[model samples]
Target: MAGDTKEGVTLELVTGSAEIFGTDLQLNKKYTFPSGTRTAVFTYQGCTLELIGPTVHAYVSNNTPMAIFANTHAGLEDICRDTENGEASRGFVVLVVGPTDVGKSTLCRILCNYAVRKGRSPIFVDLDVGQNCLTVPGSISAAIVDQLADPVHGFQLEQQISYCFGSTTPTANMPLYELLIRKMAENTAEWMKRSRNACISGMIINTCGYITGEGYKTLLTIAESFEADLVICLEHERLYMDLNRDLPNFVKTLRFPKSSGIEDRSQNVRSYGREAMVQRYFYGTRALPLKPYRIEVPFESVEICQLGAEKLPDSCLPFGVSADDHHTKVVYMKPDMKLQHHLMAVSTAKLISPEVLNHNVFGYVVILEVDLQNHTFALLSPVNELPSKVLIYTEVVFMDDQINL
Candidate 1:
């Protein structure tokens, strides 16, 4: 099929030649793909491919929820006209939520694109620390949609507000995930207040796909954290029903069908997707690859810290050691070979809290080699100098010899 995807997702190039957003894709390569809003793929000779997620048009046609969602945005836009002190005051906040593969993230993008299509600005809040569209995976991030994203280019990462979650799934550290969400909300709210247009332009928050038990409770917590006025639930009838029953009466709930094109991904496919996203983060698109300049940083110059250490019981500890060890918190790491080829984020947080450290990722670093003799670490980074010495190790580690270009 030589058609553009209504949903932006991992599109695998099978055996044939295909051009995604005008850039020809390589055989057997998976892509974080996008095609224009209504653009369709047309093959000249032959092509084979698989789109692994829901399409916006397919989902919209299921019940025309896009029109309904657009209507809601129209109402919010009307409020933007209501100004106080010559500044736009209040606007609607829509939070999209559901389990994985139900088209939640795609919906958020579509809504933002639609708003931008109408010449309106919408802030996209990505709380899906795992599969965030704006930043890398395992991050809570936000970006303002001041202009329409390229159907081929995807969301612009220039002016992004992000916090690194370090791991893919929130289940690994539930409290840390919750803390990141609250921190994301607080920061986003502060940004909204700064700009009259950003405040009145409204925002759409995309949440992680964890909607049962703690995941279900986490939904309410996320909604409350963002002060969401509307919750868009896709596919899962139980989730829609549950949110309606449990959410406050003031909060509006909307349920829509999941696109027929969406597929449930396996673990291997997910791992490949994460690798693809990280690779794309540093290196631009395959058609126009970026040359990431690498330089070595002395081990003594930067501080490396690892998050979520398993706590050892006091009985097993040595006497007179800092009696109250924050085992669950982030602790500094001594130089080791295991740190080789591992990814680290430069911390931006001035005040380090166990929970707040998640938000401080300013830039990424990949340990290239460990020099025991020289006691220096060679690392690859997009930038030359480190933004801050407070570095925290992240979950996704890349191979030293991996082809980023």
Candidate 2:
């Protein structure tokens, strides 16, 4: 039988026939053997036959790394009945990566809750240091992690995840991300031994903030170290890794982005190495602008501003200038009646120039939009240029209810 190498399942031919006292043999491995079984037990590949009747001859052959097993007439029902041994071999390890406050901790909690509901326990590690968001003193209890295991239900292994916080350094490039991942894996492996009947089934490593350059490399290294089964990237679009491209190490990936809230916005900016004032600049720069334009979207509107690589027209843009150009600042003004708040959109294209575009002196722009309803703002894009339609919509005014000519 053939199985995934990562699954750690091996095919061993034991000293038994296809049927022993009416019990049939089965293999849930990925590949199947072609040869049929006979009355006498035979061995194939590295599998050995240890006969229990009289003379037990153990066969040990060195076969191919993943060769086809061409021996076995196990019944179809028996073959089908062999369930996937997800719990047998090395358990699954999942790594969650994304910008801060994007529900990484919340999702971890949910997963733990899910494991608990299924009578299984899960460990949680809070590595985010800037905000002790995960390790809020009384948030986690050791008693809960210890109780789920029992003699009757068998030891469903669950460990209280370890935290490696405060070691992350802004100067060291990628502060301890690799170290933290390695430590968690090693520690979980150690904990697995204590369980009476069960072993560590899986591990979840939650990452912090927008990882780039060294940090990104460090994250990849961590995933590889743990032989990660799944890599969950939250709000990955903002990370700019061209996630559409296939990654090497991780078997599967999941992307989930939470809506931007005030707390989320604050955390996102802080994670980008920006000071509070710079964050304020990107968010509340224009407390009062000289002249601002307006655009209106009714409650029916859902998707706003789907952008592309089109240069905006000068006339349709705010401040009578192209939003993509360094000299322009697109500020939107809305009356506090229907929407009950004012919205301001600003571009830091001129102030920082190439710095805003990470020193890529090309036609890059930093477009920031702020919704005043809940004091939430977003640094939307740092791309080639502004979209033509978006520029037009920015300058147009909403009269009565609809945008007017």
Q: Provide the overall lDDT of each model, using Cα atoms, as 2-decimal numbers.
A: 0.70, 0.34
After superposition, which runs of candidate 1 have C-alpha atoms over 4 Å from their true positions?
Answer: 1-89, 286-289, 314-328, 350-359, 400-405
Candidate 2 lDDT over 1-405, as tens digits, reads 212122222233353333211112333322121121112222232233323222222232242211111111121112212312432444445566786556564454444433443444334444443432222111111112333222111122223342221123421223333443455556555554555222443444555564776667666666676566667677667453543254573367666555332133443434332222222222222221121223333322211221112445666667755454422222232322322211112222233222221111111112233455744322222222232112111211112121121
Once model 1 is optimally superposed onto the true structure by TM-score, how far is the C-alpha of residue 376 displaced, in angstroms? Answer: 2.0
Q: Candidate 1, after superposition: displacement of residue 292 in Å?
A: 1.9
| Cα shift from native, residue 308, model 2 (Å) | 45
Best candidate according to lDDT: 1
Which residue pairs does candidate 2 place in steric collision?
A: 2-31
* Sequence-dependent TM-score of model 1: 0.78
Model 2 stretches astray by more than 4 angstroms: 1-90, 132-177, 193-201, 238-246, 259-405
Residue 331, model 1: Cα distance from true site in angstroms: 1.0
Measured by TM-score, the strongest candidate is 1
